[model samples]
Target: MSLILEEISVKREHSFRSKIDVLPHIEVPWHYHPEYELIFIEKSHGTLVVGDCIDHFNDGDMIFIGPNTPHIMKNDDLFYSKESEERVIAWVVHFKEDSFGKEFFLLPEMKRIKEMLINSFKGIRIDGSTKYKIIQLLQNLHNSDYSQRIIILLQILQLIAQSEDLEYLASDSFVESFKQSSNQKLYKIYEYVSENFQQKIDLDEAAKVANMSKTAFCRFFKSKTQKTFSEFLNEMRINYAQKLLAEGKLTVAQIAYECGFNSPSYFNKQFKANTGKTPLQKKEHSY
Candidate 1:
């Protein structure tokens, strides 16, 4: 696996068309492009890697990725079965900053849209009422003429700009690097960690996966991700814990053990530190 920066032209006369991809399996290799992308996952559930953030995503998840942000969506085992491989129907709208011209966004009418694009560098996940509206707009765009399509796109951007519940995914440090490198090592590392995050992952074992000495791997991983390997693993485990907790089918203790935390008390402590809420508190809030 290698990270490839997808080349995209920004000229309006060479407009990039919206694409509807029906992937048999969600296995996009980690890559990025110079186009702002709005993606809606119609089906399939899996782990989503956006920039340096790692989280699980389910059907109907909608994300707006800024230009040059590395990302991928990997299907989990539950999403594939003997009956059929899970279907991933995604609608992607890609456009460049100058698609409407450099001076377009500077107009008073486009202020909100400009702000939305600026905030998208952090990777926004549209949710609630706004999400439904955007989905509808995307559908209309798919069926409309070129002029109508452009109008719809602008409307969608305006909606996102006004949305207050948009969730940020990537950290500031994970901004675009636009560097190409063999992604095999990072992919293997993430796969191993995702599969066994509930158990202990020693530095020696993880280093071997990358074919580097423990010390060397530590430095390399940190330099690439801007996060210590342990920090990344812990965050991954915590992200799983959040999903499990959200389901409301398990007790906090059960979720702690299920997520691979050695002790329930430690799990509670970390959860609070990461989310600023206790397990029960979060559960109540969710309800």
Candidate 2:
């Protein structure tokens, strides 16, 4: 995957950009853009990394991201398999501070939204009733004329500003210190791990991918992602395993091997450690 500094395309007739993405998988690697973003996932489940916060995202998940915050969503491994029919569907809006005019957001009447936008520098996940409302508004946004879309966009921001269902995804320290210079190397490591996690991974090779010593790479990865390389790898494997278990097309042992675990016993141990449930138990719960 190439290092991406995404450029959001807004048409000359439009002040901001909005669109729906329907794909077999999310292809954007670790990247950032100048525009703030609001994304609502209509269908999907996967690992999402926003700054230093790593978490699982499911259908109906939504988040707002401030300008220049690096983020990525890697669909579960099954989505990448040719035999899997899974799809990812989402609505995304991208706008800049000048979307409404340079000083529009600086006006006294825009204080609440200005504060919310500032807080979004760390990335924000919308939850509860607010999420549903925004999703609906995004739908309306897609069907509206330019004037109406702009109105709906402001309404969406207003709802988010007034609601209590917001959780910041990245940490204060990360937002304070992050710069684009480090992303190319870090994106290499992430892309490498995502592509190779279904087999043995060599620490030396991973370090070389980041152009660093093994010890230094380990520390840098942990500092950026807030998880050890091993932990991140295991989490990726477990995430795929969970998806397979939910599908009920394979035995637990089959899933273990498919997800790169050498022994079912070891897979069971790790599954429970990560999710507090054995593979079989998780399968049962899925049904």
Candidate 3:
């Protein structure tokens, strides 16, 4: 109901904490913390909010979130019903940036892991065979001893770092949306675009949301988020299209118009570019 700091359980002898949870629903309020999180959802289907990125998640879903990122998994209403048989099943690991040694990531051998850790700032979703493997490692951790626990954890990180199936959830925006922090300016702009993505948004109108000149807003946004305004807007539209695709309620052409694309073919091309799959392919996979 409110944004709060979550205290992930950590034993005095260990620098990292791991827990496997099965819940009627994930009832935590929106929150953030000072630890990197590796999460695997074994069984659940719900809306997941990460930074400013909103999307659906299900069984076999996995993501890595960096410190200070706000997130929550809000299961669908059915999961809360007393007669429902569904459950929220997940495993999560939390460790601080310097959990190993402050200088450990500085070593040459740890370069890739170090970069992957940095990328976690945007929240990375793992898919394809990599998700399957990471889920396996997380599930088997309970059977291993402390030493193996560390080894397997590192292996998981290494595998994710090397994977091409990783998708960043917030690479384009700068909103700590859940916390309602001072980053509200960017959040406002992001919200505006998300809600109006189905219409032809004027650049001047977008800049007005940021209270800056069009050129100035472009410079400021790119400087802060490393993505141009156009790029971020397209990302938002494509994400919305993905949601529509999963709903199975609209034809591809209808969805294309609903998402503000001028034509279905152009929308399909962008969808493939953003998600690595065409609309028809995603629809087929969804069922």
Q: Where is model 2 more than 4 Å wrong at Cα?
A: 179-287
For model 1, how does the per-residue alpha-carbon lDDT over 158-216 read when each residue is reduced to its tens digit? 89998986998876544532243345677567656755677878889999988999999
Q: Give TM-scores for every candidate, taking all chains together and pairing residue i with residue i.
A: 0.78, 0.69, 0.70
Task: For model 1, state the Cα shift of residue 165 in Å.
Answer: 3.1
lDDT of 1: 0.79
Ranking by TM-score: 1, 3, 2
- In candidate 3, which residue ranges exceed 4 Å CA deviation? 175-238, 246-249, 252-287
In model 1, where is the ten-residue run with the lowest total lDDT?
Answer: 173-182
> lDDT tens string, model 3, 112-217?
9999998787789999999888878887876676688889899998999899999898744454333344455565675566546779998899899888999999
Model 3: residue 81 alpha-carbon error in angstroms = 2.1
Note the Cα lDDT for every prediction shown.
Answer: 0.79, 0.85, 0.81
Q: What is the C-alpha RMSD of each candidate to the true structure, in Å?
A: 4.0, 5.3, 5.7
Candidate closer to the true structure by TM-score (higher is better), 1 or 2 = 1
Least well predicted 10-residue stretch by lDDT in candidate 2: 173-182
Top-TM-score structure, candidate number = 1
